[model samples]
Target: MSAHRLPGSGPLMVFGGPYSNLEATRALRALATAKGIAPENCICTGDLVAYCARPNDTLAQIREWGCTAIMGNCEESLVAQAIDCGCGFEAGSACDALSIDWYRFASARVTAEEREWVAQLPRQLGFQWNGLDIHVTHGAPSKTNRFLFASSKASSKREELDSTPAHVMLAGHCGIPFGETFDRENGDQGYWLNSGAIGMPANDGTADGWYLLLEPLAERVRASWHRLHYDAHSEQRSMIAEGLDNGYARALTSGLWPSMDVLPAAEREQRGIALQPPALMIEPNH
Candidate 1:
């Protein structure tokens, strides 16, 4: 894991999956600006390009702003000129089909300079945040495209956590906000934090996307999820006009993904329920 040495300063904003939604990307940046956080303190877990219509503009925004981005599977594929989005979706599934469309759309849009930037993104970013070693990656350590949700297996979560030297593993890829504090009898503990995606909703029945903030508390790291309200309607319209897939176009405003091809039954069950992820304070029992 590479290191992105960020100062343990003011409220730190971390987000994922720009997914080519320029509107969402712009709105998220505004939110951080209004919150008084600088670009250097903000980090993106990465998928800088994806389903939406404005992949180029979105990448250009973050590139000019100079935020640290971990390499997402989408970025990796785009840089390598791969065939698919590399999410490891099932063959011939709706997810895979839509991915082919968007991947081609994005691949054609990104310029050489943007591809260079994607090549420069870190696979995993590690840093000491308020006495905790925090590592950020698009997905799990075993695979860049692996999906780990709130309902992921306990053993698998523990295994990934144990393999890492960081006390906190901040992930994206799943496009949903979830936090799990794993406690071990040996007195070691870690947190699996997914900041969620600002480019698209968590399929939880709201037009707003999600992001997470790490507010250091005494002896704990406060994980807070916030809704990012962007111009989804306009973005969706643009996607439609651009001849992109209608599934993500509808997803932009409906907060409902067109396919569950990538999700497990647990996540599929939560569709349209509207998430209200509460702020959690993490503390390891000594």
Candidate 2:
């Protein structure tokens, strides 16, 4: 439960779940550089290694990028030398089964020094941009691996928002991009945003990942979701070469997850359908 405050007013790029996909991670870094977003203004919500072939390369790339990163469940498990990813998947489920293969692959490749670096990452980040207080977390404020999907209950989201004082709370881990605004009991408006994962597709029937952009406008902060197109085929090939031809490897090009075990009914029903999450404008606190 560590937290750190970031200092910057520039446009921020927030993404998550790099998931050890070196190709996708490299694409995102190039995007940030082309957009003039400094490394300090870019934040990663974690899961730097997971169901991909190049765990060590991806971890090194992100570390070299020098962005603000929160420790995801994958990082926590890796650092603790846990046997599983700690994603809280139900026992005997497909997610649990698949995780076994990738987690073992990642754990074996990640070095002691890299785990030490991940060990020091904060669990949360807070910052002020354009008069708006923003909070960042890997999953939920209460639990790092909790899956709070777009279709999750509104009350649940409100509870997480209530735990933080920020006007906007940005999170990742659900692998989908969405935005919801809640009218607080105290009459203020609160926003919950999931930047989605760049390592994997949104299961949107397209071979593209997702990222979030937050920019300050005259009177409001504009939060938008953008698709990240990368060399998915190459990544898939890499996985096959590494003897890691799991569902996630195929998911790179297919844009579909192999299991619905972790998805709620709403998210499960929307599988293979492209996502078009709308942009949200938040008024800065006066």
Candidate 3:
């Protein structure tokens, strides 16, 4: 319930699930610098460490970037020294089985000091842009490990949105970029936006991650999804070197996940098809 207000203006670059991919994290940092987006205006929706090599390096890089970040399920589990990632995958599912090795690898590599830093991260962040109140969380506002995807029911999404006073909820966890506007009974609209993940591709048959750019436009906010290109082969090599050649190692290049245990039917049907989520113009709340 620790929520901090982000102070800034102009465009905000929000991304999620760095997932311990150092190369992808570096590419994002470079992209932010190139766009002249200061660290204060940049927000990460968490999971800074997860399924990949170089967990400690990725943590260090994010700290050095100095962006505003919130606690993800991975951080929460690591701080508590949990035996699993706490990603909410089914107990006997493929995702749960695969998580065992990577979680252990990440837990061992992350230093005690790094865990301390993650423990202090807020559970949520809030900001105002062009008269719109925006709230950011690792997953749904109701649960840190909840998986809300593009195919989620509108009513379910609305319930989560109603739990907060903000006009927009920025979230990550399902590892896909999507946005939708929900109309409340009173006629005001709320937005659900996921910037996607920087550490892993969107299972779109290409080795590229995703991020979101939110820019102020008069009384509205323009939300655009962008692809993050990085050295996927190098990351694969690193994973192999670390003896972490789980299915994720190949996913780095294949742009496909090792398991679809967490994906909905609609999302599973869209696998391997490049995602073209339309840019949304977030209207001010009525």
**Model 2 backbone overlap count:** 0
Candidate 3 lDDT, tens digit per residue, 1-286?
A: 1224364777999899999999999999999999999887888999999999999899888888888899899999999999999999999999999999999999998899999989999988776767888888888888999999988997888888888878899999989999988886567888999999999999888899999999988777899999999999999999999999889999999999999999999999999999878999998765
lDDT at position 254, candidate 1: 84
lDDT of 1 by residue, 52-131 (tens): 99988888888776767788999899889998899899898999888888888888888998888788777887777677
- Candidate 1 segments whose C-alpha is farther than 4 A from its true place: 1-5, 284-286
Pairing residues by index, what is the TM-score of model 2? Answer: 0.97
Q: Taking the candidates one at a time, how many backbone clashes does each contain?
A: 0, 0, 0
Can you write out model 2's per-residue Cα lDDT over 1-286, one digit (the tens) per residue? 1224374788989998999999999999999999999888888988989988998899888878888889999999999999999999999999999999999999998999989988999888777788888888888989999999988987888888878878788899888999998887677888898999999999888989899999989889899999999999999999999999889989999999988898999999999999989999998864
Clashes of 3: 0
In terms of lDDT, model 3 sits at 0.90
Q: What is the lDDT of residue 259 in candidate 3?
A: 92
TM-score of each: 0.95, 0.97, 0.97
For candidate 2, the per-residue lDDT at 172 reads 94
Sort order, lDDT high to low: 3, 2, 1
How much lDDT does candidate 1 score?
A: 0.84
Candidate 3 runs further than 4 Å off: 1-5
Span of 10 residues, lowest total lDDT, candidate 2: 1-10
